[model samples]
Structures are given as structure tokens and as C-alpha cells.
Target chain A: MKVVVTGGTGMIGRKLIDSLLAMPELIDRDGNMAEVTAITAFDVVAPNPPLPDDPRLTIVTGEISDAEAVEALIDDDTDTVFHLAAVVSAQAEEDFDLGMRVNLDGTRITLERCRALGHVPRVVYASSVAAFGGNMPDVINDTVTPNPQTTYGVTKVIGEYLIDDYSRKGFIDGRALRLPTIVVRPGRPNKAASTWASSILREPLAGHSAICPVKEESKMWMLSPRRVVESFRHAQVLDAVAWGPHRVVNLPGVTGSVTESLQALSRAGGNSARARVTFEHDPFIQEIVDGWANTFETARGLEMGFKSDTGLDEIVNVFLEDDLPGQHVYYD
Target chain B: MKVVVTGGTGMIGRKLIDSLLAMPELIDRDGNMAEVTAITAFDVVAPNPPLPDDPRLTIVTGEISDAEAVEALIDDDTDTVFHLAAVVSAQAEEDFDLGMRVNLDGTRITLERCRALGHVPRVVYASSVAAFGGNMPDVINDTVTPNPQTTYGVTKVIGEYLIDDYSRKGFIDGRALRLPTIVVRPGRPNKAASTWASSILREPLAGHSAICPVKEESKMWMLSPRRVVESFRHAQVLDAVAWGPHRVVNLPGVTGSVTESLQALSRAGGNSARARVTFEHDPFIQEIVDGWANTFETARGLEMGFKSDTGLDEIVNVFLEDDLPGQHVYYD
Candidate 1:
């Protein structure tokens, strides 16, 4: 079996690669468990900390929107593709053309490449809860129609549609998971509006100060990094019949407020770690966050056996177990 | 003010051009009624029956996906655009690449050109009820999310998202109408599965035999050619505030079964004309039609003062008043 992972240099993508390497098994095109013979990690840049030194692993880098490059990346023998490359929400909003080029055009190029292969390779796409916004119901359900307000969200929703149509046409066996905001992401803050969700937990645990942008009561739809990687694996192995006609699902996630996140932080690293966080309201980020649907009824995803972290503590613990040891700012 | 209409040689586009010349006015970018200065009619082919001899109408033929050609078509002087170009459902399904090229890429090219002009032009796009399919409510309401089941539907839905994002960014003032299947369309039957909706009325009125591919009980969400034209005008003229945040709507249309359609046919052309229709059960067409949501509660569209044909009689009468005189097969 051969696997190709786009955006394999990113946090979730790297972790997913690690998990894939550890397991070395997935349901092949023939609907049977098979040993992973080769894994190609394709991205705009090579992995930084470096991926595991395995004979089967190969790293390749190129622009996702470039047709020739993507064609080269996903060759005839490719059995599965994990498409995670994207311009994040804030960055997409700031540079509309870049967002359209990389996120929207990039996705199409990848899908078109897969279609060209003609073997109906399994494609796992990383969609987001950013799929929901503007005049949303209190709690989003499986039936809620996506009305994404941001460019990134629009692109993600569009990608889901492309996946569905491609799957319907038997060009590709595709599944899109609408992920929630990932809590405890092991990195410095980037362009995402929800970066604070991770920073409040990650920075404090690594003995650094963090700013809380939104209010204590502002809740976010969240999942742990560990659970999300697990979801990608589960999504791949599930049979086509299990997904039915619709190829997209809103993955199960826990709703956590800033206060709740702080409590979890306190549980892990005591009062001092919790005290390292301070509120400095950024109205722009607040408005954007406020627009997102923070609660969900993921009955469809649950029925398919996809899981979320038990609570914020579990989310915090996942970071401690997997990411904390390698933290650059680690202190006693 | 100048206007550009893509697919302007098609049935609806030709009629819209006729209406524009007759009126010679539309709401300008400055939010004031202005004289129709130049109306550029762009399509893949020239009109068959010939458009009006009015100097304001200039017919240009070219591929819609050709970015340079589109750049030449929509100049900086362009004030509004009626983007009706697309590959219909059955045709798109038969040739996926053609559909993606014309329907998807063509729309992007059009929008990008408008954005480069730096002056936000009002854009009215012709989406379809094909935007709604698969597991659906018995009566689709304003809140129903689009889950298009075909390649054409997917492209239209994706176009809607692009329009929304562009509008949000103030790049273009965009409005997308999810039109019902048009009944009593003039000229010959095309590749659309819903062509029978028009053929049952159009062919018989022209003293030509027509085939009803589905059962009498089969219902369709339909609109008259005149009403849809009026709806497009209304959509173009309405202020951005009227649309609020979401720039798309399921246009108000009546649900008419084949029995009701034939009854309207009988009223206009009498029983003999109705007798020109014969049933030839096509399971393929039936399956496609069955997937569509035939009933809609377009409260939002109605509130915005968009109108549907009063009933099937009005639809039949629309054909009689506007198109019957020029019927290619007229023998009555």
C-alpha cells in the first residue's frame, strides 16, 4: 500500500505521519488491511524537526497549486491521499488572492490529479468548523447547512463539495472531516484567530506567558491534537458504505470556554501556570471568534465511531504527553 | 451604464437582452437608474433567430473559460454582469472536464476580471434548484442547505460560495438565485434532464410532438421564462443591504407535476395539442428528476419581492405571449 500526505510538514500533518509510521497498516484499495509499503510526505517545505528515519518514508516539497508538481507528487501507484495544505483563516482574509490561489486552486489541482490517476484512490481532506458562521443556530448539528463567512471557510466548504462530486463520479473515494479548533497545538502563535486557544495552554505549560484575546465566557468548539490525528486514521479505514452518499462529516469535538481551559491548565501545572495567562481583549479577533458556532451535535460522526477528547483536561494531558518534552521553552 | 451578459445567446439570455433593449435602463453602480449605454452579449455561439437590430446590443462569441477573452469582454466601463453561462446537468455529467472548465473556471475568470477593474460591479448569477438534492426535506425552506448531487450542481454551489466571498470582500456586489427548472423554454430540447418540463408545453404549442419522459405524478420546481427574467432584473437592482450578509437565495417558484403541466397545455392549445404529448418512461431521467427537491418555501425571496409565475397557466401563457409567434415549427 502507498500513501501520500499533503501539508505533511504542519503540526497535525506531522503527527498524523508519525501515527501512520508507528502503525504501518491501513485498509488498502481492495478493502483489506495491508502493510504500508511506502509513504510520501509532500508539502511546500520539508519537515523541520525531521520525520522518523524509516526506509519506506520519502519527503518531497512543491507548490500544491502547480499542476505539474502535484502530478509528480501523486503518481499512478498512489493508493491514498491526505490533503491538508491550506492558507489559514486570518491569512486567507488578509490576502484574498493568495487564499484563492493556494486553498481553492490547490485543492482542485490535487483532486484533478487524483481523478487523472483513475484508480479511485481514498482522499482524506481537512475541512474546519470555520465551515459554520453568520446567523447560525445555538448548536450546530449534522443537518445545519454551512454558510461560511470567511474566505478560508468558503474554500473549505467548496473543497467538501468537490470531494463529494468527485466521489459521486467514482473519480476518487473521498472523505472530508470538518475539524473543530485544535486545542494545545504545539507551536508559537501564527495567523489563526483561534491560536490563543492553544497558546493559553501550551505557552503556560512550557513556562511562558500567553495573552487571552476573548472573554472567559467565549466558548470554542475544540478537539485535542492526539484525537484529531486518530480521526484521520479512523476516517481512512472506514468503508465507503459506512460514509453513505455524503462524503463529509462534522467530527465530534468538546466545547471549552477560556475559564474552563484555564482550569485544565491549573490541573496540569498548578496555580502558577494558570496565573501566567492574562486577558487583553482584541475586538477584531473577538468578533471573528464570536461568529463561529461553538457547540455542535455530531451524531453522524459519533455513529461512525470518530471520537473527541473527554474534556479540557484530556486535551491538556495530550499536549503534556506528546509535545511538552520537546518544547523549546521547557522549565521545571 | 454598460452591461455584460455571458451565455447571452441562449434562450433566457436572448430574452433578457430583448427586455434590456426594450427598457434601455438599469440601476447603475452609483445606486441610480441609468440609461442602458452598451449591452455586450457574450456566448459560445451567435443567436439563431437573430437578436434585435438595436445598436446597444453587440454579440461576441468565445470560450467563457478563456481568461484573456473574458478580460476583453468585461471592460472597466462595465457596470453590471449577468453571469448565466454554464453546462447543464446531463451534459456536465457526461463530460466532467468540460463542466469543470466552462462552469467552474469560467465563473472564476469572470469574477476575477470584475475585481481587477477595481470598481465593484453588481453581478447576478443563475444558479439552479439542482443546488438542492440528495436527502432533503419534503418542502425545502429558506434555511435548507444545498447538497447538490451532480457535477453541474456542485459547480453552481461552488460558484455561490465564490460570489459570497467576493461580495464580502467588496470585490463585487454579487447575488445568486437558485432558480427552479424553467418550463416552456422556447426552441428545441437540450441535454438537461428537466427539458421535458418545457417540451410538454413548448413542442405541442408549436404543433410538434413532445415526449414526456417521466410519469404524470412526477413534480418539478418550475418558473416561467418571463418571471425568471423579471427576477434577474429585481436581483440586479436591489440594494446590497436588502441581501444582508448571505448573497444567495432560492428564488420563489411553483411546484407543478406533469399532470398540471399537461392541463395548462390543454387549456392553451386544447386537447388536441395536449394529445401531441406521449409518455416514454426513461428510468435514467426519472432517477435524476426524483433526486431533486420539487417543493420550496422561498419566504426570503418572496419577502425581497421576487415573484413566481401565478401557476402553470401563467407559465404556458408566457410561452404563448412571448415566444409562440416566432416558433420554428409553427403549423397552427
Candidate 2:
């Protein structure tokens, strides 16, 4: 089976590709294990640190919103597509047209290209918990309506709708996973408001001090990078019958307050690492975080066998083993 | 204030135009009464009966998806826009590209045109209950996430998102109304699955036979042309602060089963008119109607002073008074 991963240069995309390469075979539409023939990592930019040199792997870089480029990338031979390309929350909010062009128009171009194939390819869309906001229940259930407070969230929700409609039309076999915030990110923080969630954990573990933007009681719903990569594979392999008519699902994740995450960080990197984290409340960031739904009753995601990190410590350990690799933080 | 009404030749659009023209003055952004200077009724086709030759009214015919045409129609002088143009449900389902071009693309073009005005014109968007479908509770509320089952519904929900985002950016003070199924329509049946909701009453009232495709118990959330037109104007005048961050609202409407609507028909057009309505179950129509959310808790719509017809009789009376005028239904 041939596969294409858009946003293939990003953190989760690179990890997902590595995992795919490790697997001996992939599940086909007929529920049979088939040999993976080729995989294309398509993105706007070339992969950093570079992908491994493998005969079956190919890296193509171009514009996601360009129809001809997308069509050339997702040809008839492609059986599965992992669409992860997007502008982060804060950045999208800052540049509305760019967000619409890259996020909304880009997703549509990808879906349209898949439809043109005439073969219903499995499209695994990466949505976000930002899909839920405004007046929400304390604990969001599967049934809560998506009232996105940000441009990125709106575009993500719109993409989910497009995927579902296209799937219903038999143009594509799609599955949209509303991912929780990923914790313990390996690299430096970008434009995402939720970047602070990872920064406090990632920076300290790397022997760097990080600013905690919100209160200790401020909570976040998060999934590990390893689990998310696994989710991409799991979602693809699942039978279309498993998803039924609705192609969207909110992935299950562990919820932790800022104080709880800090305590977990101490267990992994010691009290000195936790001491490296200092509080400096930014009301702008706090308001955006406050609007996010922290507690989710994702029964559908759990029932579908999508796994979540057991706790923050487990997430921290996964990051250390996978990303840091034998590196240790020194205490002053 | 100058206003532009897209889909100006359609049932609700024409009625809305008449209502607007009748008003001596309109409420401006500052809650002050302003003179009714000019009104443009724009559509793909000219009005069937031909709109009244009033000095203030200008009828322009063109494609809604054509950005140039849209821009030409809506200039800086335009203060309010009623975006009602769309591809009906069944037609949209059959022709996916056309639907996307007209419904989705058309809405964006309209919003963009308003944004270009830079004056932050008031935009009243016509969304639908079709925005609500798939797995839903017995009664839907403001909070129910829109999971559109059809292409048309998906586009409408997308339009709502666009309007809300644009409103947030202060490009346009937009208000999206999720209209219920309009009953007792004046024109011939269109491609909408809910056409029977009006046809069962309209055709019979017009002294012609009509087909009831679904069972008598099948319920529909309905509103009158008069009330919906009132809603468009009301949405325009209300302070933007009243809507706050979220600009979408599910308009309040009375719910009635097919039997109840027919009973109301009997009162207006007598048993003879009711007898003209014959049942012929169409599973396709039944399925579509079944998927619709018939009950709603529209607290926001009500609190904002949007109103619904008292009952089905009131709706029938509205049609008789507004559309039929001196013409009476003939009882055999």
C-alpha cells in the first residue's frame, strides 16, 4: 500500500513516518495485511534533521494549497493520506487570511485531489480540542457542539465537516481525530498558545529555565507524542464499519493541572528541574487557555481502542526515551 | 441606509424586500432611525412577478459565485446585506461542485465583499436547521454541535463559521440565523427534501392536489415568511454588543406533525383543501425529514427578541394575508 503524509516535516509527522517504516506491513481496506510499497512525506518544507535514507521512502516539498501540486502528490496509487498541515492557534488568529488559505483551502485542495483519484483513500485528518470552546459544560462529552473561539479552531472544525461530507459521498474514507494538546514536545516552542504547556516540561528537562504563563490550578488535556503517532496508524487500520457514518472522534487523553505536571516533572528530572520553572502570568495567554475545554468524556475514542498516556510521568518518560535519548539535565 | 438582498427573487427574499420597502425608516448602527434610501434585490433570475418599480429599488441579475459580479452588486454605499442565496438540499446533494461553488464559495465572496467595504456593514446570513443532524438529542439547543448529514447542511454550517469569524475580526457585524423549514410557501415546490412541508399546505390552498411523502406523525420545525423577514431586519438593527463574540443563533419556531399541519389547513381552506392532500410515502424524503431536528431550545434567539409563529394556523394565516391577499381557497 502506498501512503502520503501532508505536514510530513512536523514533529508528529516525522515520528509517525518512523513508526510506519518500522512496521512490516500495513492493513488494507479489505482488512488484509499488505506489504507497504512506498511512502511519500509531502510538506511545505523539507524535513529537518532529515528523514532516513530508505528505498521505499520519498520526500516531496511544495505548497499544500496548490491544487496541481496536491494532485501530483496524491495520485491514484495512494491508498491512505494523513493530512496534518495547519497553522497553529495564535498564528492563525494573528493572520486570518493565511489561516483560511493554508488551513481551510489547503484541506479542501487535499480532499478534492483524493476525490479525483476515484479510489476512496483512507484520510486521517488531524483536528484539535480547539474545536470546542465558548459556553461548554464543565466536562465536555461526545455530544457537545463545537463553538470554536479561534480562527484555527474554526478552520479545523470546517475541515472535519468537509471530511465527513466527502466520506458520506463515497469520495473518500475519512477519519478526523480531534487531538488533545501534545505534551513534552522535543523542540522549541512555536506560536501556539498551548506551547507553554510543553515549554514548562520540555525546557526544564533540557536544563533550560521556562516561564509558566498561567496559574498552578490551570489544567490542560494532553496526549503523548508516541501515543499520537500510534493513533495515526490505528485510525488507518480500523475498518470503515468501525467509524460508521460519523468520521470525527475526540481522542482520549490524560488531564493534568499545571501543579500536577510540575510534580510529575520533578519525579523524572528532580526538584531542581521543577525549580527551573517560574510563574509569570500572561493574561492574554491565560484567557485563551481558560477558553479551552480541559475535561473531556471521550468514551467514543476509548471504546474505539485509541490509547492515552497513563499520566504526565509516562508522557515525560516517552519523550526522554524517544526524543532526548540518553541526555540528562544537570542540577545547580 | 442602502441594503443588498441576494437571492432577492426567492420566496423569503421577495417578502423581506417588500417588508423593508414598507418601513418609513430603518434603525442604524447607533439605534437611531435612518431614512430608507436605497435597496438592491440581487439574484440569478429576475423576479417572476417582477418587483415593483420603486425609485429606491434596483434589481440586478447575475451569478452569486462570480466575485466580480458580487463586488459590483455590493459597493461601499451598501450598509446592510441579506445573504439568502443558496443551492437547495437535494440539488446540492446531486451536484456537489455546484453546491460548493454557490453555497460555500458564494457566501465567502459575499463576506469578503462586505469586508472590503471597511465600514463594517451589517450582514444577515440565512443558515438552516439543516445545520443540525446526525446523532442528536430529542430536543436540540444552542449548544448542540452541528453535525450536518448532507452537503447543503455542511455548507450552511461552514457559512455560519465564516460569518462568526468575520464578525470577530470586526470586518462585518454579521448575524447568522438557523432558519426552520418555511411553511405555506407561495411558489412551486423546489428540490428541498422539506418541500412537502409547504407543498402539503400550499398546493392544496392554491386549489391543486399535493403529495404527502412522509407519515402524518413526521414533525417539522417551521416558521412563516413574514416572521423570517422580520428576523432579518431585527438581526440588522440589534447592537453588535448584544451578540458578543458568537454571532450565530437558532431562530425560535413552532413544531408540528404532518397531521397537525393538515388540521390547520382544514381550518383555513376547509376539509375540501385537506382532502386534496394525499399520502404517498417516499422513503428517500422520509429519511431526510427523519434526520432533521424538529425540537429546539432557542433561548438566545428568544432573548434577542426573534419571534416564531404561534402555531401552524398562524403560519397558514400569514401566507393567506401576505401572499394570497384577496385570493381565497376554493372549497369543493
Best by lDDT: 1
In candidate 1, which residue ranges exceed 4 Å CA deviation? A328-332, B328-332
lDDT by residue for model 2 (A28-112), tens = 6556879778999998889877898888899999989999899899988888899998887878999989999999999999999
Write one digit per residue (lDDT tens) for candidate 2, span B65-136: 999999999998888899999988888999999999999999999999999989888899999999988889
What's the lDDT for residue B138 in model 2?
Answer: 96
**Candidate 1 at residue B129, lDDT?**
88
TM-score of chain A of each: 0.97, 0.96
Where is model 1 chain A poorest over a 10-residue stretch in terms of lDDT?
Answer: A323-332
Candidate 2's TM-score reads: 0.96
Docking class of 1: high
Please tell me what DockQ candidate 2 reaches.
0.81
Error of 2 at B115 (Å): 0.9
Q: Estimate every model's Cα lDDT from 0 to 1.
A: 0.92, 0.90
**Fnat per model, in the order given?**
0.85, 0.85
